[model samples]
Target: MPRIALIGGNARPITTAHELGVDVVLVHEEGRYEPDFADYCSRILHAPIGDSAAILEVLRPLHAEQPFDAVLSATEYAAIAAGEVADALGVPGTTARTARALKDKAETRRLLDEHDLSPIRHAMVASEQETADFAESVGGRIVVKPADGVASLHVHVVESREDAATAFKQLREAGYTRAIAEEYLEGPVVSVDTFSHRGRHVVFGMSEYQMNDRFVEWEVSTPSRVAAPHRAELTELVGRLLDVVGLTDGPAHSEFVLTPTGPKVLESHDRFAGSGAPELVRRACGVDLYRMFLAVQLGFEELPQTSPVNDHGAAIRFFTPQPGTLKEITGLDTVDALVLTVPPGEAKGNIVPLLSRTREAEVVVVITRHPGDTLPELRSVKDCSSGYVIATGKDADEATAICERVVDQICFHVE
Candidate 1:
């Protein structure tokens, strides 16, 4: 069996690697991996996934004894480090130089601006004064986020210098020493879930989102109707991004805004789109991207000759309850969805995706709350979710409708 090293992702890919009869080693942060992941991994190692030196320390010895065929990462935060490991091991995957550049949003923005690919006004700010200066230069609202932020953490929209300083301070406290400040692009943002294999790029489709004031995506639907008109534009831009970024394999999602001028790229990722994007891809297009990630690395699958088309639709609607003590929750009889158990604030068990299937439609409900746990407010993508409902239908509208109807039935009573 071909041995593969998967760095810093959920258990889905580990399980996929195991089922494919590959000897998989999982490298993750201490106390961060799911318990059930050990069952799938041939060897489970612990290291800060962001620290390339530490990860190489653990993997280098093992690799000398038995070589690893490739290194893979589906998580956004660890993609660069995973690439570094692959390069250090002389493995086939994302290169170290490419991953480092992609991880830095400011660097990618500079590349885009230099190439005149998708120009969005941006600057790299290291201090509050720099942030404020950039914000003032825009003369309008600007978005300030961690230079390597993931899961929408510490993203601040500031219109004033004071606001920019405050945002910078918050990021500083969060241990992010530097940040990217950008002129706020005013348009409906959509995700282009594109994949590449050996320099070839293809977009599976686009997805739309419903975001809160805090930028928490409450609802997500694939094959966006609003973005369909600019398919040619998005496809062309992604092709350019792949070329400029040197993304070699796996999934890389680039977000673009349908601005008044046209489509301008907001940002990009060298990994699979999160928020159950692989599930959405599987439902809409007959492609399991997560499985594809593992299979291609393990040499069990080949890159497709043509891109998969999105025929149907799939949607996920999160349950965002009030931030208070939970009193009670009602309305379980309406939807026959799976109930996943977890502690109120945090979960330490297997993040199993719960699904109830039938021929016509399928419903997957992942509930992270119970009767006594306090619910947190919508913040970053990490701790905000109380639960979520995922469904698939004939079209994007129908899939979104199924999610909304199911979400309406579940009620959370918070004190």
Candidate 2:
């Protein structure tokens, strides 16, 4: 039997790995790891709490004993660490340089600027005055975020000096020492997932991104219903970006904005697509991205055969109900794909509001076989459809209309 060792196994990708029939050897502590499905392997390894050197030390003995056939890093930090270990262990993986470029927002933007890919007007600010000045110099309105953070933590859209000050203060309170402010691009956002092996990159699928506020991503749907012209343009642009970035192996997930000027790259991840993206893509397309990555790590010369498995699109929407004691949920039976981040009866701390807050109460996802299914059909029937809905359409107008319907559904309830 082939054995695969996975670091950062505390994430969504671990579930994907389990779904793909790969035995998972979790590196994190037993209590911290959670899987939605049954695991084939009951093995557990304690992970280093803070230091990378400590993690390496813990893994050194495991590598000698189990002698894994492949190793996968689930998180950005782990990916960077895994790169070095892969080289030492002669296991195939991403380079530390590539992982760094993708993980650090400041470095990512700088590299993109240097490549003349998308000229992002941005600055690294450590103080309120510097943030205000940077925003003013970049024309006042800007998007501010942490250089190395995930889940849209401490992200803000500053419209003026005052807004920048508030955003800076919030970042400081959140323990962020530095943040990057860039000219906010006004347009719809989309995410693309790809797989690269032996210098060849294959585009798996593209999905539309729905944001709750400035930083929280609420939904992702595959086969984004985008205008034909824009879709063609984006496809071409993404292909070129993969070449430019030299993404030669493993998986890549990139986000871009479809602006009037054209498609601009927002960010990219040099790992398996996050969230339930791998599963969503697999449902839409026959590709099992996790298994493909596993094959890549094992040095398989030929890639797996992947094509659209279903004619219809699939989408997922995350929700955060009014942050309070979990009373009850009323709409799970009505939805096709639903995952509650916080179970019922859980006290959700004061979540940020949609306009200013970055988190939600829960997440609801919908999958449909019909291309014409509107967002209204996907909306939760409870509370008169007041909660947020994220839908994926076969093509752009469908996606846009679905998003509009989701926005409309969210307005049914007002605090």
Candidate 3:
């Protein structure tokens, strides 16, 4: 059996690893690890997943007892630790340098600029005036965001020096000293989700996003219509990107903006696409990325020489309910799907588990916030965690319509 060490993710990968007949050890922080995961793994190890030394300290002894075939992670930050652990233990996985280059937007920007891959004007800034200077140089709209931030938090779009200064002040107050200011990108955003083996890249699904002003994706669909004409270019670009970053295995979710000029990279990750995107790929391309994450690592599955064809269209939509204390949520029973509801103000660890389990249900309704919970204003993905709907259709449009129709049937009564 291929013994694998999985760091800091939900239960999907754990369950999949078990099904692969691999002996898996799950590493996560205390209280955060799912209780149900015990059934799938032989041991559940706890660690501060983001800390490389801490993870190494825990896994080193276990690795010495019996060497691991691979080290992995499904989370964003923990992937770096996984890489570092893999290197330290002399296991096969992404290198720390590659993971860092991919995770840090500033590093990615600099690397891409050096290679002249996906060109976008960007600068790392330390002061408000420096940010304003970049904005002034752009002479139009610009986006200021944390160099290593996730979930669209603290990302500010500004066209004026005053707005830039205001955004810088907010970021500084938020304890983000390392920020990047870049010229704003326009056009539809899409992800060219790929799986690679030994540096061979295969495009699995080109999922497109529909976003709110905050840049949080309200909905995403597979087999990108907007990026249809640019599939070849995108595939090549992602291949170049993964090659540049030294990502030789697992999934790559490379997001891009289809500008009038051409496709420009928004960002990319060294793990599965977030927010139920792997599910979107399965529904559309008939490819299971979660399965591939384990299967490819152990060399049980061969890398498809060609990109998997999308047989159908699929989409996922999130619930951005009114921002207030919840009074009542009604109309859920009308939808023919698995509807999970918690107290309005209760804890919601909703997204990851629901994304993988909403199988066979044409529509899935997940409500993370229950009655009396305060729905803070949707400033970032963090605030818009009330719930979401994932659906499928004959095409992206159809799948999106299915999600929309389901959302319509469910009503949130927030005060």
Which 10 consecutive residues of model 1 have the lowest summed lDDT? 350-359
* TM, every model: 0.93, 0.76, 0.96
User: Could you tell me how far off, in angstroms, the CA of residue 229 lies in candidate 2 after the best superposition?
Assistant: 3.0
Query: Each candidate: what lDDT?
Result: 0.80, 0.60, 0.84
lDDT of 2 at 310: 46
Q: What is the lDDT of residue 132 in candidate 3?
A: 85
Taking the tens digit of each residue's C-alpha lDDT, what string does model 2 give over 1-415?
5566677643344554565566666566434444331354546677652234655677678778877666667665577666666666776667667777777888888777777877778889998888888877877578888998765667788887888889989899989989988888878888877787776666777877666654555566777655235766666666666666666787888888888888888888887555456655764665767667765656544665443434546554544444323334444454443323333212111111121111121224321111221223222211112234444456334544554544434322212
Where model 3 places Cα greater than 4 Å from the true spot, the runs are: 341-350
lDDT pick, better of 1 and 2: 1
- The candidate maximizing TM-score is 3
TM-score of 3: 0.96
Better of 1 and 3 by TM-score: 3
What C-alpha RMSD separates each model from the true structure?
2.5, 8.0, 1.6
> Per-residue lDDT of 1-415 in model 1, one digit per residue for the tens?
8888888878777777777888888899867765677888889899998888889999999899999998888877688888888988898878877887788888888788788888878888899889888877888899999888877889999888788778988999999888888899899989988778778887886999999887877888998999989988888888898799778787898888899999988888888787777788789988877777877655578878776877889988888888898888788656776545454444542223332121234776677777778777678776555777888889899999988888888898999
Across 289-366, the per-residue lDDT of candidate 3 in tens digits comes to: 899998877889887888877778988887878788888888886777778654433333435444556785877787
True lDDT of residue 137, candidate 2 = 86
